[model samples]
Structure formats: structure tokens, C-alpha cells
Target: DIYAYGSTFRGGEVGVVIVNSGSSAHEISIGGLAVAVKAMGWLVTSNETSSSDPLSARGVMWNGQSSPQSFPLLSLGAYSASLSDDGVLIELPPYSAAGLVVYF
Candidate 1:
């Protein structure tokens, strides 16, 4: 299953959250933007089999620190897209979540 939530700021910035809860991956397309901008996302997942264990996220440096081995801030690339006619596409992995932001 896939869940998405989006919000638009007064200044026209866009923030989106996409979550995939199932055991498979999916491709999602988003539209409605005035201009195209760089889109970035982080991959979050859990390593523990127990439900009580907390989840961890990778991609993008944290606290302005450069930990290339830790969080290798990733470009959306194949997982995300910029299309003609102001559209965005995203690929979500199973049991993962992406917090997407786009500037107009």
C-alpha cells in the first residue's frame, strides 16, 4: 500500500510525504507545479525484526556534518523524476518512506 500527503506553502514551496507499507515497490506520479526544481528524498527503514525496535533513516547528511559513510545523501534519480508539463514521479521501496520537498 502507498500513502501520500502533500502541502503547499504560501510562498509556493511544496512538501510531500510518500510511504509504502507493503512488501513490494511501486512507482508514483505527482503533478501540479508551476516550475521544475530539484527534488530530494531520504530512504527510511527498519533493521530489527521486532516491531518494538525503532526505525532508522539514511541519505542526506545530518547536522551539517559530512559523514559520507553514514548518510550518503542520495539523489532521487530513478526513484524520482522531473517530467515535462510540470510533473514529478517517485519510486518507493517496500516498508519505506520518503519525505519529498520541491521548490517552485
Candidate 2:
């Protein structure tokens, strides 16, 4: 289970995802939607066929009949999927992007 006990915000839209690498379902909690750390679950899938696919090459992934993949998979970014206020994003310091994950 993943629990967030701090504050998080974005000057622009932000996407957050939480994955359960364990064999069983995990629990998650955030303080709030705006200030709380956002989280979501990503189902484990088979080997990726495209660079755009979620087939993370970081670790050994189940080929539909194997074990779990390693952390840090190849996923799309939120900015590429969502059209946001250009000014809002452009004005943010580079550190902002470092802190947030742009999920699709």
C-alpha cells in the first residue's frame, strides 16, 4: 500500500499514477485532491511492442506468463496528452517538471 502524508500542487494540470508490483492489491491514501499527493493504479501488462507502449524495459516483465517488471517504465507524458495553459506551464521553473510526472 502507498500512503501520502504531505502536500503537493501543480501550477498546471498534473497526472499521477500508482502501480501495485505485489501479487495482491495494495492500499493507497492521500491527504487531499489539491494539496494531497494524487495517485492511481496501473495494471501490469505484457511486453511492450512500441516505445509508446507501457512495456517497461527497466526490468523483467511478464510476457503474459512471467514475473513482474522493474520500476520506472516507459510511459507517456501528460503534457503530450493534455492541452494546457501554455503560459501556466512555461512559467514554471524546471524544478516543477522534475517534481511532477506528466502521465497520459
Best lDDT among the predictions, by candidate number: 1
- Model 1, CA-based lDDT: 0.60
lDDT of 2 by residue, 76-97 (tens): 3223223233311211111111
Relative to the unseen true structure, what is the C-alpha lDDT of residue 98 in candidate 2, on a scale of 0 to 100? 16
lDDT of 1 by residue, 1-104 (tens): 88888888797778888888777788887777546665655555444323442234333322222334532345223234454665776667556677777765
How many Å off is the CA of 86 in candidate 1? 5.6
Which regions of candidate 2 fall more than 4 Å away from where they truly are? 1-11, 34-104
Candidate number with greatest TM-score: 1
Off by over 4 Å in 1: 48-83
